[model samples]
Target: MKRRFLPVAVAITASTALLLTGCGSSGGDDDSLGKAKGTGGGGEDASAPASPSPKPAGIKRPEVKLPKSFQVEFAGWTNSDPKLQAIMDDGKERLLASYAAIIKGDPQHSALAYYSEGDALRTGTAWVKGFSDRDLTLIGKGRVYQPQPRISPDGSGTLFYCVDEGKGSTKDTKTGKVTATPAGDAFVLYRTKLRKTDEGVWKTTMVQTERRACK
Candidate 1:
């Protein structure tokens, strides 16, 4: 999901500002963690299922529905630790919820709010609004891969991943015109922070995306 409004470098800086506002004074922490390498490729398609998967006995998960025109895949995201795996799963859901909001032309979509809070919520809302304001929507396929997740001693967590947008494009909502995105802008690296709630759902609190940061 590259935006056409600003240059990539400028957008990266602005997005960082939006997501890192309250990330604490320990500025070096994120830099060090960002260097960790992740491994993964190919993921299950993100098309909505006819019936949602059964929820775990005691946990509550939101149902996310996306139009068939848009698809996302998460590759090699398994973790040996169930807790870490849960974080990755929710992070994937959070991203889908955001894209769903954009495609639906709703900046304040409830599903998006369900998986996000704090800086992530605010910035995610604004990002969706950008497309809606321009009467734009996305179509085609997107891939998220190479996820590296870590949990802190205090229960908070961070995830780093790469996104491939080469097969995705933006469409005019009213005019039905599709614009191909540049190959150079198709790859991005993302870093996000999350926390688990009492209900056992992990919600994203912050995010940072760097264009051309991945191959």
Candidate 2:
């Protein structure tokens, strides 16, 4: 199975095979990533369970620069809790950063800015490695929407969202040939678990994914 996050770094076996598209979320059937472990606090100390010690520079995140041709829509999504909204907002930001990293084939940049030491981080690492190993680059367009979040009774945060990967292609850096990405009948659904680090920043610890008919 291909690992999906911004995109699966699966090596392109055929000239027709495309790499990952959209943002970070693993691919598979109801396969979940990461574990829930949090003691919740605000501002510095929310970084969490097994994160690395503070580096001299601090956790690096991306500035998120989207292509002007790109379009993103929320699609009838809203949240009532101000705090939850903030967290969700951060989650989307991280997703955007993830997308940038995958498209750029720079998982290290993403590792520093987003994702902690967990399944999410692992998935991101694999994707970057896979693509680099094959000397392939993913090219595609996508939009996100329909994000709904649930707060655990213990106050742990979880989120569900969708990514629509439109038409695109993958290019072989070696041959400089472009292969059209296979068209999909539906969008991909993503389930993510979130935790605040000791620094009070929300980070994705785990991600689960599956494909379903677009509504």
Candidate 3:
């Protein structure tokens, strides 16, 4: 997945949790899918259990104040911009498709949703590695303002955009600093590159952000 970049470094420490047969509290940081938080798990502090996965490491976080069905609506609809709008229904699904992992700051989730594959997960995370401030030059920050259906100079594929409505905040795993953050003022934006596939629907080839100067 491609993203807009801010000029900062954030250390994102995954809880290194594993979804064992037992049921834990499933906090935000707890990775219910893979490794454990402390031991043998390759995530963070293998020595002891972290309190709860706080927000992304370095970025600031906006309160969950969007309308109830935000992400779903975005994921489910294919309407054009301006004339069309994201509502409670499709908006919520859109968020679930991507932010399901975006909320956790996991690049794997982004890669799969946008690229329709897992190849880009590692690369996506690297863009935000060590991100520390709003001024940071990470992907997915500024491009949100650009129009949707963004096509390359050659006009090969389509691109889309969004604000921090669904993806949540990006954190520093090592230092716990949030890098890309959302404030409670207006809509955040992102640029997503896409293409139609044999499946007959537009597919995201890349997702990215362009950093902005907050007034």
Candidate 4:
């Protein structure tokens, strides 16, 4: 997590962010999702039955668009399962809007509406507060690359994506001085778990983030 791209309390230290196992891979080109287990190994048990998947909830994921101000490019999402595809498609918009809201420093922004009442909401509030407290604003463009959707046997879905902030920057509010540049040895990776609400909205339940650097 680079300093310029992070919002106050949401900022992760670079040392811990760089701990990802491999730094050589671009984190792109891998569309494989988690695999399901099957019965019968070398010597299988005859009495066992395979686990059944949950029925589709018929929920519709909402559509999201990036703000014209931020030049964020997404690698796109992929999922072979129809139900899970709907879930991922909707989740991606909320995810992007979350980032956009942070960049704009607007707590009341519509993007903030996507976050539920957990870490996601807390982090979103912190981002807006950081800008207001420091009298600063973000001034840069970034990109994100995420893998296909991976749904659990119980129906929860996990999405892993990388954020490249090397091209962005931040500046002071009053002095108008360039305080921070986005480029550095660091980038960010996020792992978010989402579950549909009873109201049929796909909300993020938990988010795990790690900052990594280019080798």
Compare the candidates by TM-score and give the number of the best one: 1
Q: Please identify model 1 stretches exceeding 4 Å from their true place.
A: 1-17, 20-28, 38-54
TM-scores for every predicted model: 0.83, 0.64, 0.34, 0.63
Every candidate's CA RMSD: 4.5, 10.9, 19.0, 12.2
Q: Quick one: ranking by lDDT, best first? A: 1, 2, 4, 3
**C-alpha lDDT score of every prediction, in listed order:** 0.74, 0.52, 0.31, 0.50
Q: Which scores greater on TM-score, model 2 or model 3?
A: 2
Model 1 pairs whose backbones collide: 42-75, 43-74
Q: Which candidate comes out best when scored by lDDT?
A: 1
Q: Which stretches of candidate 4 lie over 4 Å from their true place?
A: 1-67, 179-182, 213-215
Position 148, candidate 2: lDDT: 64
By the TM-score metric, which is better: model 1 or model 3?
Answer: 1
- 86-166 in candidate 1: lDDT tens per residue? 788888889889889888989899989999999889888888777788787888887777778888776798988888878
Cα lDDT of model 4 by residue, 1-215, tens digit: 33343432124332123322322223333222212122112122222321222324674333444455445555444456776665665556665666566556576566556644465566556555556456666555665554445666666666665555666555566788654443453366556666776765557665555555211
Clashes of each: 2, 16, 95, 1
Lowest lDDT sum, 10 consecutive residues, model 1, at: 45-54
Q: Considering summed lDDT, which 10 consecutive residues are worst modelled in model 4?
A: 33-42
Provide the lDDT at 102 for model 3: 38
Q: Is candidate 1 or candidate 2 better by TM-score?
A: 1
